[model samples]
Target: MNSETTNPKHGALPPWNVDELPAPLPFSLRNALRTIGPGAILLVGAIGMGEWIAGPLFVVQHGRSVLWIATLAFVLQSLLNLEAVRYTLYTGEPVLTGFMRMRPGSKVWGFFYALAGFAQLGMPAAAAGCAGVAFAMLQGRAPTDGDASMVTWITVAIVLVSAVVLASGKKVERLLERLSWMMILFIFSFLLWVNFTFVPLKDWISTSAGFLSFGSIPENVDFVMLAVFAALAGSGGIGNLAIANWFRDKGFGMASKTGNMGGVWSTEQTLAPVGRVFPINAENLKRWRDWWRYAIIDQSGLWMLGCIVGMFLMTNLAASLFQPGMQVSGVAAGVFQAAEMRKLWEGFWYLALMNGFWILFSTTLTNVDVLARVVADMAWAGGAVPKKMPVGRLYGLLLLGFTVIACFGAFLGDAKLLLMILGATAAPITAFSALQILRLNTTLLPPELRPPLWRKIALVLTALFYGAISVAMFHQIFSR
Candidate 1:
């Protein structure tokens, strides 16, 4: 018998190359946070659209009560992220690869997921938003119709620079993780200073209460904006899927045995085409539990809590600075806030713009990396390209292609419209992936490693939640 047949539960796919799971890092709050990497990358990629622009816009227009949606979105998406990671932990392959392990196989699911990822992230909205901030910083105002060319070129520059950064790392995940930590520290430190100095205590209490006041959605709420808010509120769409890829690259769990995407000109890629599974003995089970605990803390504490804090701070600042019904939208959300803060101290305007620039730029950089990495990964796993080509070279080619596409896509519309389309597209994709992840975890995994009943329920609810958002959004679109 093959090694995998030693256990009857291993029949879901091709036989796994059996191996022992490595011991997990020591579990303390500080050690756990320091050792974890993927969540930081995920958090930085997430904060720009929802926290900075969409969530704040909703609060400024409707009220802080609308933040309940952000809270719920974060909770659901966190579960989705954890489940995605669960696959990577076992198989040493990305969750997208895990989706390919389902019945129809890699060829079919690969094409569908590649299409889905492109649809969700194709437009370089965050880069455009970053350019808008740069324009205000340079020209002392927001872009208008006359300045479209200038903004487009600025966005192109940002995309190109992101490619360069993505190429610089020894392992792409480490570079992203380091950048994420630095940016998070600066972003939070500045935001905390702004909040403590300017925002009133009562506004803080109200915003905190708003998150728990479930079902407080305003009657006249802009469902379109709400859709965008829900999607971007966490690592919505393909960003959530990419979390597994990052986990694999970061050498989490069994992924330590797999190869990761490397810098340009790195060694030949040797990632396992199929995942390796461990025998379900007591020792492996204990190690599995330790790894699972670390994953929970990484996802829940750093990613989920960070997203919540980001939404809360951004919305609270908006609620404090802007008037209700202010018509703040798009890049103007940041512009208006800076304008208001300038009245207090002129430097606040400049600082606010810089902060927005970092927030949006981080997302743009990570989005560019995510699109290129995922498409390359799918192509590699599905044998769509020559197996001999290095994965990094494939990623480099795709990154170049996406940069060109994003430059053209930037001219498709203004930042807000582009971001809205991006988020809205992600809702359906997230829903579809949630269902696939549920299936992958329950069926492909051994009973020992499969998620418990509670996790399964959460995954079902996650799919339904985003599914409803998708339906509501399409209904709004067609009815109009």
Candidate 2:
């Protein structure tokens, strides 16, 4: 029998090796850290699309008041992400790995994963195609005669870029960090630009809500505005789960399982200093000081949650600048007309805007690629897919196919419709992912590491939030 001392209820504690205790914590001088590596890229990539695109776009369309709603969603999603990361880091396992322990044959779990694969291929393709179009728009050139041609050009770009990128390997972790910082700088610069060019916050928010919404004023609220809020609130925090997985892969996995037969338990209490190849806690304490803490820092969630917070600010900024009378589409993205708005901050920076598009859409391309990889990985796990199958390569190809479909949709000027379709289609998946994560923790984890009472509260909240959003979307999608 294992002899380590541990909290029987929480599985194993972390930050410690199963060996004996070590010397006191060392004080080392470390440089300011950078958000590089998988964590950085994942966060930036997510913010590029989820926040920079989805969140701000919503702000532009809906009034700034919607900021409150989106902010709340970010908080909720962050909590979920943190929880997942904390556990995975402790277990040295992916959240999905735990799902295997959930009584085996859950067709329900398997089915959604399969469906998610399909969606993954499509989403990245679409995002890449959109980015391509944005790129083309910058040069004042159209690749094809119409939108369809434009999408094709974009799809080709995404494929080429991904191929080139994947072929040459700089560590993705470092690459992601650089990209995120660049994006952050860009956003900050844009904020500065907007502050100088636009009206003051007070002036913008004073505008009439003729069709916008407030808690009590039903008279001014429009369905479109409501839809915008719902979508941003629901979809914005998606990256958190990924964050949890990444951190789990970091060092949190072996956390709870480290007890020994010895009498005096030597436990570790903190993270290792940077530049250390491996974390150096020498004792295998059964329970962590903040044992469940890693659940919060997954790759997908870390930057995304922060970005959403940024976006909430953006929405508020816009509301303060041009609320009561502007359509989101018209404000940030009007055609280059010689109107008063075009002369000021409202005027589009075809260059910066186009670059933003590239950054934004490439993530989609990446997203599609990620999804395909995930799907292929899922199949590979089944033992049904051939061991020799180039699943990763196959997934890349699948992404290309999705790009084609997305370009076709974009060409038809139906991108909004596509967004709506994708959003609605993924809602059930989102809900399932949330529920699965929560359930996996509860049912599969050794009771010691299972989610605590507060997490149970969070799980309930996530369910209702997702369920309510899903029901509302279902009504709209099939309503017509």
Candidate 3:
């Protein structure tokens, strides 16, 4: 067969001529460094204002002992993220999709995912709102009443972020990844600097420095406590899974590559003018499965897992730094604001904390949309929505519309008040977790990838962590 006669076509390659190929051994060191991808970007998209504010605040308040709490929180939160990966890898189902696959006869299981997409409608807007406020704060232009409302600034910031994301397409990822790396560097820099510069580091870091025991609490009860916990750990909180599931649903998760059915490309020695021809046989074909492979190759893929832990530690840090007794919302919103815009620009450092807000809330803008999509996906899969409509898109539209209405409602009524006054917002998730555990136990996952014994043990441990937090929250609330 002549090489000139056979050109490339379809998924099939030309016959593998071993004699025509060159021997492999020429990878440049510089070329090898260029292959990273979107994992870090995803982390940046998620680990925002929360870390900058909460993590730093905790460090300031709790002293160095805050490290223990931050570490534990990271581990616990990361385990859930790990579950997100595990659930999505082989099956390609995200949290909402997983909810759809729940047991048929289970008690009230369907409701576990009914409103999953509610966040989609407003998350982007909410995130933008926060980012704008943070951005203003960072720029030393913290909004005061008549100068410029927080709402307007947030709206503008969100629009800008969205425009950037939309315009950049794939390129936005590279920028995001770079920024997230910077955030990590910032955290480490502070950690290192604090470790060295602070004089009390040795004395404070000792074993005698202990956690507040239950007995340390005054033997008192407060009724409003449970609601605080409910607010903290509500349905919209476990967003790690919601966003991750989105990436999975988008085909970023592990996939088993079906074997190549065409002629294989083989390497071999070749003559000068004429390229050689080789055999076309079953042996030449290759089959490859891409399951769990995303973990290795995709840069933006697994990086979110690490960031989730970072954010969790950040939460603990915040709590440690600024627990109730030490401060109660008195952190001035306009600490260094000048009436003039010129002064704001002159004080660039004022905007340092703005990135923190940008980090969490910027990504939150699109998150609710993904959540809405997830809910729709689950709804369609469960037959709650008509098949003709393609539930995901239909529900996404509905969720979007509803969010618009909700935002309007925010003007009419107190959005924050409306959000908390509703219910034990986490009930849907608690239900889902229970069902997920049961499903895992009853052989839902493949045997080989079924959670190991330690993971199984961790299920209870994780649940207890949540429970303990809940109880502690209630105790604190009622005692107050």
Best by TM-score: 1
Model 1, 1-480: lDDT tens digits are 333325534332455677888988777777787668799999999999889888887788888888888888999999999999998888788888777767777788888988888888888888888888888899987667577778878888887888888888777888999999999999999889999988999999999999988988787667788888899999899999999999988888888877688766677665665567776788878888888888898899899999999998888898998789887445454466677788899899899999999998899888998999898888887778887788888888898888889888877877788888889988888888888899888877777677889989998898898898888888888988
Error of 3 at 34 (Å): 9.4
- Candidate 2 scores a C-alpha RMSD against the true structure in Å of 8.7
lDDT per residue (tens digit) for residues 282-346 in model 3 = 22111011223433333223453444444444433333323333421212221211122223354
Tell me the deviation in Å of residue 400 in model 1.
Answer: 0.8
lDDT of 2 by residue, 206-288 (tens): 33231134343234444433443443443332333444433422233352232111101112212121101112232323334
Model 2 TM-score on a 0 to 1 scale = 0.70
Worst 10 residues of 3 by lDDT: 255-264
Ranking by TM-score: 1, 2, 3
Error of 3 at 358 (Å): 3.1
Candidate 1, overall lDDT? Answer: 0.84
Which 10 successive residues of model 2 have the least lDDT summed? 269-278
* Candidates 1 and 3, the one with greater lDDT: 1
Q: How big is the positional error of residue 44 in model 3, measured in Å on the Cα after superposition?
A: 3.0
Order the candidates by lDDT, highest first — what do you get?
1, 2, 3
Q: What value does the lDDT take at residue 2 in candidate 1?
A: 38
